[model samples]
Structures are given as C-alpha cells and as structure tokens.
Target: MSAPRFGRITAGPAAPAGGEALSELLAGGGARVVRIASRGQVDPEGAWYDQAEDEFVLLLRGAARLGFADGTERSLAPGDWAVIPAHCRHRVAWTDPAGETLWFAVHLPPA
Candidate 1:
C-alpha cells in the first residue's frame, strides 16, 4: 500500500500575465482533478470547448463568467460551482482583471 498525499488547494504559483495555468492534482479510474489559476484570460473568439467528459468546476477565488453556445452566461464568484455536461460547448467569457481567479475542477467519465 502507498501512503496518502496531502496539500493545500490554494497553494500554487501565480498565473502568467494575461494567461491561465493548470495543475493536475489527481487522475485515475477515468476521473481527474485539476487546479486552474486564471489571470484575465478569455477564450479566443468563436472558440469553444467541447470536452468528452463531464466537468464539475468550483470557483475558489476572484470571479468569472462562463459562456455557452446558446448565448447564455453564468457568473461565478468565490464558492460558486457549476456542472458542465460532456460535449457541451462553452467558453471562458470573463475573469477579474486585477486579481487571480482560482478554480477547482473535476472531470468524470461520460455517461
């Protein structure tokens, strides 16, 4: 057997200017956990993410907005969360420009 791992989710390096950084926390058994740090980054125009797995994301710091292909948007603040279905087209609409926006995300096998 292996020992358990431990660490703080909020502990990490700052994201680069006008960009975002991703850190994989765990992955196995068709699931993955990730930490995302964003610094005023937005998805490119006309671009969308159509992922193969369902994603559950929680905002841990700062603020953000998620845009969908249906022209709807969801605003997220600290402690807010959303579940994105697999293959659902979406994009990062906005993020706080003066501060870091941290997110905790889990990707699960498609159903």
Candidate 2:
C-alpha cells in the first residue's frame, strides 16, 4: 500500500486568464476528486457539459452560479454544494471576478 498524502486544497496555481485551473487530487475505482479554481469564468454561449459521471460540487470560497439546460439556475456561495446527475446538462453561469472561487468536486461512476 502507498503512504497517505495530505495537502491544502486552497494552495495551488492561479487560474489562467479567462479560464479555470483544475487539479486532480485523487482517483481510484472509477471515482475522482478535483480542485477547481476559477475567476470570472463562464461557459461560452450555447456550451454545456454532459458528463458520464455524477458530480458532487462544493463551493469553498467566493461565489458562483450554475445554469441548467431546462432554463433553471442555482446560485452558490462559500459552503454551498450541489449534486449533478450524469448527463444532466449544465454550465457555469458566473463566477466572482474580484477574487478566486474555489470548488471541490467528486465525480463518481453513474449508478
């Protein structure tokens, strides 16, 4: 077995201009944990994500908004979370531009 690992999720490279920075923290048994840093990022018009895995998203800092294909929207602040089912179309509607918005996401294989 491998030794355990530990680190700060908030400690990472900055998000690129007009883009987000993604760090894969762990992956095994068809599941993955990721840390995402964003600043003033949003999906392009008509763009959406349809993932094969279910996603659990937790907002750790700043604020954000998520838009669904069904014309619904959800706002998120620090400490807020949401679970997105596989193939559920969604997009990043907005993110705080003044500072970094950190997100912790766990992706698990669809049931």
Candidate 3:
C-alpha cells in the first residue's frame, strides 16, 4: 500500500482580480477545512457570519481584523489564531490589501 499524497496548503487559485479566493482542502465528519486568500476582502455591508458550527482560524500570512457582534474586534498577524464559538456572530473587517492574506479555517460541530 502507498501512503497518502502530500499537498501544499499555500497552493491556491490565481490572484483574485475581483473578489476573494476560496479553496476547500478537506471536508467530512461534520468538519471542513478551508483556505481563504484575501486581498482586502471584507464581509458585505450589514452581513455577518453566524455559523452553526465552531470555527478556528489561523492567519498563515499577511494581516486581518475580525469584528464580533458584541463590538469587540481582533487584529491578527501571521501565526495568530482565533477560535469562534458556534453561532457567534462575527465578520471579517479587514485584510491586507497590498498582498495576499492566507487563512486556514477549520469548521467543527459544536461541543
């Protein structure tokens, strides 16, 4: 038997000339792993992410800002991470516009 293949997470779609770029790395068992490439992409006006599952996001490159429903916000740099509980209302406030901002997201069912 052969071992599973190895893939680079940094490999993503071509530079988004318009909107944000997204790629799913894995999905199963009530969980999903997604890679998001951003260049100043933010949640639409008056929009928020009210996911049914918890999410953990890691900043692999560039910088970003997260806004919570409670008015609190978080700034993330490379190597930073944030865990958002299920049903927590939040939205992306900012992403580095000068270069690529890569994010690794893990969505899991509630505990």
Candidate 4:
C-alpha cells in the first residue's frame, strides 16, 4: 500500500538519549520528518555538517542557545524558527532547565 499524502499534527514519544531528543512525525519514502525536543546539557562534539539536506527548525517550547561556525551565538525561545542551510557547521550550546526544549525539524533536499 502507498502512504497517504496530506497534512496533520502528529505527536510521538520522546527521544532516548542524552544529547538530543526527537519524535518523528513522518518517516517514509525520501523524507524523515520529526519534532525535536532538546536540552543542551553540553556543547556539541566536533564539527558537523549536513550535506544531504537543509534542516528547518522551529522552537515549539522551552529555551535554548545555538552556536554557529562563525562563533556567533543566539538564544532561542518558544515561537522562534530557523533554517540551517545545507553543509553549515553548527552546534547547540545551552538550554533552560525549567522546561524541556521542544522544536520541530524538517529536513529537505539540499539546494
């Protein structure tokens, strides 16, 4: 059977890990869509880049910070959204403990 193509609001269980949390809303075909809940317990390790797809992230709940390759940092809170271009090196730097960091991440084919 083929997967249904449409729009909806889907929620799933929390991710199991220490660094990042992810609950996939859709995982099929050429796409792996998910909602990310993160708590930056520590700075990210090493330099990382996404060559296959650009990541689109939206802060759905909680507060956090992001560090980029250019050494620039930004604090994020609920209702904030950003798009990280493909192949960009970046990392999570910090987060608030009062609440669990929740964000939506949609990965798309690279330009």
Which residue pairs collide, candidate 3?
none
User: Which lDDT value does model 1 have at 55?
Assistant: 99
Candidate 4 regions with alpha-carbon error over 4 angstroms: 1-11, 14-18, 49-51
Tens-place lDDT per residue, model 4, 1-111, is 878766543354453344566667776555667877655444656655545778888888778887888888888888898888877777777776545677788888555
lDDT of 1 at 84: 96
Residues 9-106, model 1: lDDT tens digits: 88977787688999999998999999999999899877999999999999999999999999999999999999999999999998888999999999
Q: Candidates 2 and 4: which is better by TM-score?
A: 2
**How close is every model to the real structure, measured as TM-score?**
0.96, 0.97, 0.90, 0.75
Off by over 4 Å in 3: 1-3, 15-18
Cα lDDT listed for each candidate: 0.94, 0.94, 0.86, 0.70
Candidate 4 residue 34 C-alpha distance from true site, Å = 1.1
TM-score computed on alpha carbons, candidate 3: 0.90
lDDT of 4: 0.70
Residue 6 CA displacement from its true place in model 1, Å: 0.7
lDDT string for model 3 (1-111, tens) is 857866888888744633478888888898999999888787875689999999999999988999988988899999999999999999988888788889999999666
- How big is the positional error of residue 59 in model 1, measured in Å on the Cα after superposition? 0.2
* Pairs in steric clash, model 1: none
The predicted structure with the larger lDDT, 1 or 3, is 1
Task: Count clashing pairs, candidate 4.
Answer: 0
Candidate 4 worst ten-residue window by lDDT: 8-17
